[model samples]
Target: MKKNKTLSEMTEEELVGEFTNASIAQKEASEKDKFSKYNKLFDRIVEIRNERKIRPGDRRRDLLPLLTHDNIQVRLMAAIETLAVAPDAACRTLKEIKDSNWFPFAMDASSTLSWFESGRFRPE
Candidate 1:
């Protein structure tokens, strides 16, 4: 991986790779958060959030259409990651590309929507 390059300096392909890494980290079953890979991805995701905070860039929103990326992993990652920065827009997009109910990643995206809709913690 290239070092010292800010997230803003990354190309679209590089951003996709970073998001893919994040998706992997999020989906991993191991109850570990100290791992370098996961931490690195977490930082990148935060960087994106902060970037959007300062200036709402069209480049960032460009990722919206990637929800239907030919690669399912990319499509899956795009939704959950985008949810952090663009919840309303991400939810709208997720509704269109969420694949069938049987798609595991679709379920992941659905769960993210549920997480947002139900609030952080809801007790029965």
Candidate 2:
């Protein structure tokens, strides 16, 4: 089953699909199991994003569009994924989310902004 694939085994499209579904699930339901799945998938996606950052090419372009997706979680995760390699654009995305005033997302964006200020979001 597709769900059996390890994080390293997932293609970029597959990763995006899981992230999008997780975002949808988080939005449509408040169940603990549902949110737990989203949280796990989000952590996996972030891990892969960070790993890819250490590679030699520009990959942030692929995630940039997701920053503006209709799903709040998708947008938030995309902002986190892009923060290191595309600081200016990611910061702008975070600002937009923060200004949108959706409390949860704004709070996440605000914390991410603090990471930016502290240089914790990017590798030295």
Candidate 3:
């Protein structure tokens, strides 16, 4: 009979959990070419980011540990999101992913790095 907490009321750990789940769902949706679902999940992840960013200490760096997650997509998303907080670690992870020759994700990592380098994508 416990009431469910809204995302805004969740703790930092809860927000990270939500971000992880949303990232996984987004990856699955993308694989199925479900653009609508994927986009929704993407927005949710961004909302989580915004929520964390405005917190007293800016806990977005809490995602840094996920940079080594078993799921490549999760790791990729974490690296991309944490770029502004930990640029060196994030770039190293992206390079590792790209160099691993893992299709789709490797390509994504490479493209993300290129975008960062060219100032087309700025991690907030």
Top candidate (TM-score) = 3
User: What lDDT does candidate 1 reach at residue 52?
Assistant: 44
lDDT of 1 at 16: 58
- Count of steric clashes across candidates, in order: 0, 0, 0
Clashing pairs in 2: none
Better of 1 and 3 by TM-score: 3
- lDDT agreement with native, every candidate: 0.61, 0.72, 0.90
| Candidate with better lDDT, 2 vs 3 | 3
**Cα lDDT, model 3, residue 49:** 83
What is the TM-score of each predicted model, taking all chains together? Answer: 0.50, 0.71, 0.90
For candidate 3, give the lDDT of residue 114.
98
Q: Please write out the lDDT profile of model 3 over residues 3-112, one tens digit for every residue.
A: 88777799988988988999898788878989999889988988888888788985978999999888888999999999899999999999999999997789999999
lDDT string, candidate 1, 28-97, tens digits = 5223544676556667676765554455454455567667666554565566556665677777656655
Assess the local accuracy of residue 44 in candidate 2 as a C-alpha lDDT between 0 and 100: 61
Evaluation by TM-score, superior candidate among 2 and 3: 3
lDDT, residue 101, candidate 3: 92
39-92 per-residue lDDT for model 2 (tens digits): 666666666666556655766667787877988767877777777667788888
Model 2 / residue 10 / CA error / Å:
3.2
**Model 3: runs farther than 4 Å from truth?**
none
